[model samples]
Target chain A: MTDPTASAEPPSGPPARRRGRPSRAASAGTRDRILTAAREEFSAHGYDKTSVRQIAKAAGVDSALVHHYFGTKEQVFAAAVEVAFAPALAAPDTLAEGPADGVGERLARFVLGVWENPTTRAPLLAILRSAVTNETAAAVFRRLVAAQLVRRVAARLDLPDAELRAELAAAQLVGTALMRYVLKLEPLASADVEEIIARVSPVVQKHLTQP
Target chain B: MTDPTASAEPPSGPPARRRGRPSRAASAGTRDRILTAAREEFSAHGYDKTSVRQIAKAAGVDSALVHHYFGTKEQVFAAAVEVAFAPALAAPDTLAEGPADGVGERLARFVLGVWENPTTRAPLLAILRSAVTNETAAAVFRRLVAAQLVRRVAARLDLPDAELRAELAAAQLVGTALMRYVLKLEPLASADVEEIIARVSPVVQKHLTQP
Candidate 1:
């Protein structure tokens, strides 16, 4: 390796083209760092309360870097939320291969899988919290979840009003999450995920496929 | 007949035991003052954002007086949200008495009553905003809403899973509200409440009473 003080003479020719590997690696690292801080800030403080500076500080980066990478606070939040809910999007594919004897059980398994994982759960908590405080955040969250999670499940059913039913089913699952994880309501908070799916999935499936 | 200077003296002997009529008037006025200010504060800045001090200042009263009258911020918020949702609460009772052949029409009328009025809509926004952000607020809101509005409707329905259906029906109503008002989403936002009710109420009624 060259000495620490040695200059790269080739870089002075044409603005020194950035090596794709280093830039891509640097970009991903910064992006991940921003998301980590955003998840924490948004969860604890909420959307309206969470500032760009706070997130940047937490991530140990300049605030301008966050802005450069994500563009705005909402974008940063949306990116974090997208990552948070990514598992739910993968469920449709997973469920497709599972035996059809018990769609409800499969769906419940998918839902619990997302909510139980610390990686997914924390970001979802932030989204849920933000959805209540900032209207813009809620809209962004609703569109993302509706399209990625709710609609996929809905499409699996053949019903006239599958869209509305899907929304209803989504509400139940989301409501349970709110009560158990966020509100810490009793009985539900203590109940196992399998039990919750056993109790709640038939209701969701009924809404989905039933007339 | 007493001298003007003597009239000012602590009302002479034991304050004349203050009469009943003016006391009632004063109490009503104080209650009204507190509610009116609370509404304005909750409306202007939402539940989590508004403080008792802000409300007290708006109402031209001591913050202690506001607490003395309402007990807590939640109590004040509950009152506001209750007043906001009361008009819609009348739906179950109206459905109980009205023609069942036009169930959708009747239900639509009742839903419109809540959405069209600013007094009802403002505090509702505050409560919903709080429900999304604060766990304590969400628990109280869910309890108050379920007991006062949803349970009443569910009790009138004779179905295998009336409670579950009730929750589902509520999800329809609340989810729609979240979309239309909080998100101010397209089509749903500009669409007349009557049209929404016409479209949605049948689904609600079906969830409630259908096998």
Candidate 2:
């Protein structure tokens, strides 16, 4: 493609400055690059220590371009968290795919499975580490995980105190992740994923379906 | 009371240089002060950002004196964790005072009660935040928690995989604390303590006592 919009780098002429807008695909690519860089920077340095300029440097872009794309560091962190957790956040919808009786098992398997995978675990771990120490980051993380993931799962269930139950179930899973992944506590940290699921799913199931 | 060891501060003048040792109580008090300062420093700045010099300054002691007392920052952190968790870690022994069937409820109440109290929660939260980000800190924290807290509770259970079950129960409670305290996730964070006990104790009870 010889299309002017298809170029990965901006054209090297005065006309490049005059261009009204880049193609939608090109904009999306730049946004994705910035997000990837932000995740890496935040993960390595945490919320307080990381800056937009550092993120932009990591992304090989101008700092002003990062501001143009994400506005503020908090907004950038929010966007990064949204990307990191997108898969796990979508996992609650799968509860509908299985029989009502096995929903707990399905939910446990889904949540833990996301954590067990290396591909998703790295970025998610960074967000979690930062969130644990930084209040602002924690707030964004709490809002996203609660609203997008936990509450949605609660809504699907027909039970009293559904939200509370859903959150309780989440506590079990989230705690497991914190211990096994973050804290690296023994037996739990080294134990097989299936074993954890076996022990924890029933608890989750009880929280979800039981009164 | 006339003994040189009874003095709160080092005795004034040349006599101080000739003294063999301070009173045991005074030494312990100095150590306690240092540990308290270490906790505050770690809490405010976390592991990487905290310094031995900073802790010494806060404790109103020379940096060399801090080293003489605690040896290293890691040792200082370990000591701080021990002091911070002393009450909660001791709660397991109380399980012996209650009936087997009620162990889960007692355990949940005891652990959550420790978290509910502000005196212990502040320093413990610092350790948790440090553990989440730094591997060395996490390892030290994991060892102390596993050895001092989780395994001790597991040992009391007559059930098979008592350790695993104990850890699983811990996961639930720990998860609840992470969400409610650290992440401040809603419903769970704001919910009445008794309601949380009513909902979570049974799950914890199941994990510990059930197959």
Q: What is the lDDT of residue A105 in candidate 1?
A: 63
Candidate 2 residues B11-127, lDDT tens each?
A: 331122346666667677777888999989989999888898899889887776676776678888888888877878776796797887887789889888989988878878988
Instruction: Give per-residue CA lDDT, model 2, range A39-70, as digits (tens).
Output: 99999999999999999888877776677777
Q: Top model by lDDT, which number?
A: 2
True contacts kept of 1: 0.17
iRMSD (Å), candidate 1: 4.3
Instruction: Please give the DockQ score of every candidate, comma-separated.
Output: 0.20, 0.72
DockQ of candidate 2, scored on C-alphas against the true complex (2 decimals): 0.72
lDDT of each: 0.65, 0.83
Candidate 1 docking classification: incorrect
Residue pairs clashing in model 2 are: A175-B175
The C-alpha stretches of model 1 lying farther than 4 A from their native spots are A1-27, A91-119, A142-211, B1-23, B98-113, B116-119, B157-164, B184-203
